[model samples]
Target: MTKWLLPESLADILPAEARRIEELRRKLLDLYRVYGFELVMPPLVEYLESLLTGHGHDLSLRTNKLVDQLSGRTLGVRADMTPQVARIDAHLLNREGVTRLCYCGSVLHAKPMGLLSDRELLQIGAEIFGHAGVEADIQVIELALESVRLAGVEHARLDLNHPGVSRAIIEADPALARNAEDVADLLSTKDVTGLRAFASETPLQAGSLDALIALTQLYGGGEVLQRAREVLPQLPQVGQALADLEQLAGFLSDYEVSFDFADVRSGYGYHSGIVFAIYADGWHDTLVRGGRYDGVGTAFGRARPATGFSLDLRALAGGLAPAEPAKAVRAPWGCDPALSAALRALRAQGIIVVQVLPGQQQSLDEFVFDRELVCEQGQWKVRAIQ
Candidate 1:
């Protein structure tokens, strides 16, 4: 019995949390549908080979693997929905037209048990496959910001980065690219000392190195992009990424959404361009993260430009208002046919009807405030509590 205790990181989301999450998921998915994204729900369990191949190294390792009981084959619980969606696009939705997909489900991964970051986390996200150009990227960002607003998340900050900028710098200097992980870590820490030392040893372009260092300080609403534009003027690819970002911002302007340019943090290395993470006030982790992965589609032999974003449903639920708890009701212990008939009528109306016994707490004061009922006047009249 002691060995059967549940793990630490895993938790059961009670009614309130579950209900709140359901509402948010519905709202977000509805928004996705309005924007032309068709909903796609991939199987929760898939062969390890199929699931692992499409994902980045970092994410692949986090997947929880197990042997299937039915077939004695290696299987994995999805770590994230994006890759599963990618595989679906490659294998099933191979049509030339764009395929937009929305998903909401629990993803299982390895983690300390019984914790908040347990093996299971709920995710809600959208993926746009086969669409190309900066316009697609802009649509993803705009939709993300709009969803954040719909969730009632004020003070949400959208941070944008171009994985391509880093890629470009890498192309100009393969040595630096090989050490990209080191550079990414140092930049995230704003380690000026380490950056200067690394730059001195690497044969990276002096101008690009300088811009990279200055980018660490570039954060805030749109102005950060302006600053980045001025700093890396000589780098055409970097400039184009910035311009694309500006276009994305412009589309979001109608919604009065703001963003910050986060050139320093290069997250999700596989992200080819326009990587983004959204942070709401009082939240410690990103509420959503995604980007354009043009190369991902091509990796499957289908060349297409695509972009999408996914929301961390658990995080969003924590930040949103608590769901109103289900009202508790008690069944009456009366033998009167008239009272019983009245109770049945109330129940049919979706009302929680409770009957009080001889000694049990029957007064309206005993139950939750939201719990109310219609009273029968013992074959005289019917009344409802105020």
Candidate 2:
């Protein structure tokens, strides 16, 4: 075995890809800033209790645990940063009115979440706390769509599903309590054959049974919402969730919005409210998965209405090539004031200026240098390499 080799499903990010990831990070964070989202960088690790506060079971399972040497208490490498932000909002900031927070960092998972091998991921996201309105949900949804568009996936489709939709369905039929696991599996996968058998065994009326079965096929554009309202049983929970979905669709009217009613309990990390995922054209994996996770902050101190979205930066960066490498202006090493001033000036202009070391013989291939700073006729100037 190679001594320097990384563990399975883990590998080093090479220069080119690393540069792309960094560039995208800056661009997205800049956009988040523009949208009134203040960036907050949480630590890469935290105590297991604080990090896994509420609705973080999936997160807990994925987290890599270790014992803290000093405290002898178990610590965990975060598999998600959302809980940390929740703690910040609920306990640390403790501010009133809506709060907007954003974060970007690496998360480690015990198992692979791979596109190529996803033992680790660079997660970047934004969240809105203290607003419970569907309007807030719409804003974050639009923000998510714009984010992926800014990431260069302009044609991605935004698939919308409210975990509440499935919740409503279950609540409407209490008898389903016993068959909950089976129904959840069938609905989530849209397994028609299995659902038919399960629905027949239930004591639901022919009308209700038909509606339940129809939901599995009720996935498409705006019309699905209308059909859902007409076909699905009108339990109050189902009605309110449908209305929320309707409003969400209206706000996102310009984009290609989709509804998946059968994706019961659709969400991420114990998301109790609305949930959404983004799929780019020609990309098999989801580009983003996020939505409301209200009350997750209760475990900290305050339970505020909250919503947000997060995406893996590396996955998206892989699809789009990094910007053209910055052209480098190489300078010969010197103690002369003219050379130092010129180097400082170029750097100030956001130019890449590399100083060649004393007697360090190298080819252009050794480092990227397209132009050079030279002394021509005893005057310092920038010149192209011949």
> CA lDDT, every prediction?
0.71, 0.81
Give the Cα error of residue 106 in candidate 1, in Å: 0.9
Off by over 4 Å in 1: 1-5, 69-73, 112-119, 189-209, 255-268, 299-301, 326-386
Clash count, candidate 2: 0
- Candidate 2 global Cα RMSD: 3.0
TM-score of every candidate: 0.81, 0.88
RMSD of each: 4.1, 3.0
Tens digit of lDDT per residue, candidate 1, span 301-379?
Answer: 6656678888778878787766665555455576768767867876798866666667875345323434444444445
lDDT of 2 by residue, 1-386 (tens): 68998888887877777887888899999999999999998999899998888753456678899999999999999988899999999888999999999999999989875456578889999999999988888889888988888878868888887767676666566766556656776777778788778776778644555665777888988888888888777778778878888877888889888988776533233777778888886465788988888899888879999999999898888777544555799898999998899899899999888888988776543247889999988788999898
Question: By summed lDDT, which 10 consecutive residues of candidate 2 come out lowest?
Answer: 263-272
Judge candidate 1 at residue 313 and give its lDDT.
81
**Candidate 2 residue runs with Cα over 4 Å from true position:** 114-117, 172-186, 193-213, 264-269, 358-367
Clashes in each model (backbone N, CA, C under 3 Å)? 13, 0
Candidate 2 clashing pairs, residues 3+ apart or interchain: none
